[model samples]
Target chain A: MPKFLIWIAALAALIALPHGLSFSQQEILVFLTINVLLVASYRLLTLTGEWSLGHVVIMGVGAYSSALLTKKLGVYVPVSMLLGGVIAALIAVLLSFPLFRMKGFYFLIGSFAAGEIIRLLWKRFRDPFGGAKGIKGIDPMPDFSVGFYQFDFFEPTSYYYFAGVVVAVCLWILWRIEKSPVGLTFHAVHWQDKLAQASGVNVRAYRTLAFAIASGFAGISGALLAHYVGTINPNAFDIDLMVFVLTWAIVGGTATFYGPILGCVVLTVINEVVLRELGLEQMRPLIYGAIMILSILFLPNGLESIVQKLTKRRAAGGAPERSPAE
Target chain B: MLDLLAQTGLNAVYAASYISLVAVGLVLIFGVMGVINFAHGELFMAGAYAIVALYAGLNVPFFLAVAAGLLFVGCLGLLMEKALFRPLKDNPLGGLVASIGFLMILQALAVMGFGVRMVHIPPVTQEVIAFSEKVRLPVARLYVIIAAIVLLSALWYFLKRTKFGWALRASAQDPEAAALQGISITQTARIAMFIGAGLAGIAGALTAPLVSVNPHMGHSVIVTAFIVIIVGGVGSLEGAIVASVAYALVHTFVTTFWDGVLADIVGLSLMLLVLIVKPTGLFGSADRA
Candidate 1:
């Protein structure tokens, strides 16, 4: 019952959170929400024990697909977003054919090479991709009314609420997937591929499944950003951003589901609010790099490990009286 | 048309020289240490910046600046090994992530120190070796080519002929057995990191006058090096050289006839093909990586 109340309270806080922020902070909140999904999806891929440098490009695939589908084919904004995710998943599946042939460091390099080729293709083909400038004037989600609230697409607060709900649903689905047997198979493949294969688990298929699903969610995040920003270029999803995502995952520690999310939120707050206020924006990358290294060296288990330790201590101390009787 | 082909060939040779230099260093580091040094391209950039500061800013002689660049970047490598790689020796991925952090630090420092614009160094020389009206190679490019040949030959002789070379090779092949045989992993690692980083630094310094010198210039160089090392086979110095030459030929011709983007596309696609056909690379055995 207490856990249920905590969930309700958390939901209430999320719903009320954006109202207190300034205009730019609300905007940052919306991006932070989308990035939460991006990093979470990235964690799903990492569960299979292969870290890819191409994930942001896969996200770009989603953004591009969503943008093009709405502009050229006249698809509805919401529908195009779903299609964007589906296309990104399909592309991941296709890439897996060549990419899955290698493992470890080779996989990392191959994926990077594959992503660069995709980006270059977008650069070379100006017809639909808009060359280097990328697709602009992207269609925004049409404003609509719900019974309790009106969603004005122009307002960051409204967009935040809408994206928040969408992201919550996506996170629920990801959580459920992680808890399922499929997720267990992903763990198995990661830890002991040979053993998993020997147990008739088809390791390659699970790896492909994880990659596809992760790309699908990443695509959705990209679509959300595309509709909100109304513009994107190949540079928007370059290696610099990819490194940021990688750092989030690493610094957050990928052992638990919420680690990367925590890493993303904390880093975003540090990057956006704290740094911006202090007027150290130019030193953001340098400071960020230092943070990444320090975290890796000192907190190898991530911020969640601290959370875990605290929770364990609370459980031990608080439950000591009833433990023997129980 | 024949003259154009010859000119393209010369360009390919120059490209091959610098690229092989970078790729070989990458290979050497990967071989000796079981970690991929993602900061390698940044190390190359540091070398170029050394020349930028010393040769261009302080008016040092070009050759003296090149030597300084090599030694300085080599020292940077040693710092990485001691500070980052050594502690995370057991976890290759952690080492890689740390190197990436190092890469960002280097890039940020470059940006802060030099600002974002491309830095122009006065050309080392105005002379060009003319084979024909269309076929010519600049003196600066000649210096890079000569340096690559001499340094690589020296590296080859050192690796094949010296006691330290055997120790490095043995450790690369089997760290556990090498340790059992009384080889100092730390010492070998230090040597490998220094030479590997120095090689990349020298390549960057030599080619600084010929190419655009910017903080982010390392990106394309690293990409080219990755393609070459993968095509040649990871951990194989000989394979890196062979693959570099082949890649440069194909890329140079494609850029000459078509466009630079297409040339990149081709180079990447060729790497993918090699990866698909032979993941161990053309010359590498399956056990190394």
Candidate 2:
């Protein structure tokens, strides 16, 4: 019952959180909400023990598809977002045919190559992808109203609330997937693919499944960003952005479901709030790099390990219970 | 048409020289340390910056600036070994992550020290060698080619003939057995890191005059090196050189005939094809992958 109340309180805080921030911080909050989805989806792919360098490109796939569908095909903004995710997933499946042939290091490089090819295609073709400048004047999510409150697409707070709900539902689905039997198979395949294969689990199929699902969610996050930002370019989803995602996942420690999300939130706080306040915008990458190195060296288990210790200490005097949500 | 082809061939040879230098460094570091040095491109960038500061800014002698670039970037490699790679020795991924962090730091340093714009370095020479009426190779490019041949041959000699070279190769083959045989992994790692980084540094320094020197310039160098190393086989030095030549020939010819973007696509597609057809690379043994 107490845990349930805690969940309610957390939800309430998230819902009300953007109201207090300045216009810019509220904008950051919206981006933070979308990034939580991006990093969380990234964690899903990592569950199968393969790190992909092309995840941001897959996200770009979503952004491009969503923007194009609405502009060219006259699809509704919301429906186009879903279709964008589906297309991203389909692309992942196709990439897996060439990518899954190798494992470990080879997989990393191959995925990068595949992603670069996709980006190059986007750059080479000016017709659909708008060449290097990418698509501009993207359709925004149409505002709607309920009895209690009206959503204004122009306001960051409204977008924040809408994105928050969508991301929350997505996170719930991801959490459920991680807890299911398929999730266990992902873990099995990661730890020992041959053993998993011997036990009747199709290793490659599970890997592809994880990759597809992860790409699907990443695509959704990209769509959310596109509608909000109203513009994107090929450079928007370059390796630099991918590096941020990679650092978030690694620095957050991928042992637990919430690790990467926690990493994303904390790092975003540091990068956006603290550094911006300090007027250290130019030194942001330097400081962030230092933080990544320090965390890996000293806090290899990540911030979650710290959270676990605090929770464990509090629970020492009481009966042990598994947390309902990971 | 024949003149254009001849000129393109000369351009490919010059491209091959610098690319092999960078790719061989990457291969050497991966061979000895079992970690992909993501900061390698930044090290190459640092080398260019060294020449920028010394030769361009301070008006230092050109060859002296090149040597200083090699030593400076090589020392940076040692620093990475001591501060980052050494502690994270057991975890290859951790080392890679740390190298990425280091890469960011290097790039930030470059940006802070020299703003984001392209740095214009004065020409080292004005002489161009004329093979024919239509074919020409600049003296600066000749410097790069000569340096590549000499440095690579020296490296080959050190690896095949020297005691330290033998120790390095043995450890690369099997760290456990090498350790059992009383080989010092730390010593070999340092030496390999130095030589590998020095090679990349020199490549950058030698080419700094030929290309636009900028902080982000390493991006393309690293990408080309990756394609070359992967196509040549991950752990093979000779394969890296051969692959570098082949890739340069294809890329240069394509760029000459078609657009640069299509050339990039073709090069990347060739890499993908090799990856799909033979995951171990063209010359790599199966065990390495």
Top model by DockQ, which number? 2
Q: Stretches of candidate 2 above 4 Å error? A: A316-326, B287-289
Model 1 lDDT tens row, B206-240:
98887889989888888899999899999899999
* lDDT per residue as tens, model 2, A257-310: 889999999999999999999999889889999999998888877777787789
Candidate 1 chain A: worst-modelled 10 consecutive residues by lDDT: A317-326
TM-score of each model, in listed order: 0.96, 0.97
- How large a fraction of the reference contact set does each model reproduce? 0.50, 0.61
Model 1, C-alpha of A270: deviation from truth (Å):
1.8
Model 1, residue B48: distance off in Å is 0.8
Residue B42, candidate 1: Cα error in Å is 0.8
Error of 1 at B201 (Å): 0.9
Q: Write the per-residue lDDT of candidate 2 for residues B125-184, one digit (tens) a residue.
A: 999999889999999999999999999999999999999999999988888889999999
Q: Evaluated with lDDT, which candidate comes out highest?
A: 2
